[model samples]
Target: MKKGCLIGGIVLLAILSIALGYYFYQQSKTDPVVYEFESPVYQEIIKKTVATGSIKPRKEVQIKP
Candidate 1:
């Protein structure tokens, strides 16, 4: 019984060590993503109209100085 317990303890220790090593290896290969953001904002958005044109005088008025 003592021999069996010793063997089991050694096996359990080995398994734990291997699992821990694999866990750390995977962690080292990964980059942790940290996301920081602002809270929600409620407001009105105004829509603007874009026009392309040139203004011309309907009638040319001559001014004498």
Candidate 2:
């Protein structure tokens, strides 16, 4: 049947695509070229910050009014 042929073709295409993808992935992992550089030393830093008071949530209020 034509439908059966179409289905078979589609399945074959999917299998071939997956196989190619896996082959390329394996190839890349096996013959990989890596280049790394030494990073600069980091210096410790101390930062100071101050925050101004702003409007707060209703739950945070004393509600004495």
Candidate 2 lDDT tens digits, 17-39: 99999999988786567999998
Number of colliding residue pairs in model 1: 0
Which residue runs of candidate 2 sit more than 4 Å off their true CA positions? 30-65
* lDDT tens per residue, model 1, 1-65: 99999999999999999999999998889677899999999999999999899989999999999
Candidate 1, residue 50: how far the Cα is off, in Å:
34
TM-score of each: 0.46, 0.46
Q: In model 1, what is the error at residue 42, expressed in angstroms?
A: 41
Residue pairs in candidate 2 whose N, alpha carbon or C atoms collide under 3 angstroms: none
Error of 2 at 21 (Å): 0.3
lDDT of 1: 0.96
Worst 10 residues of 2 by lDDT: 56-65
Please state the error at residue 10 of candidate 2 in Å: 0.2
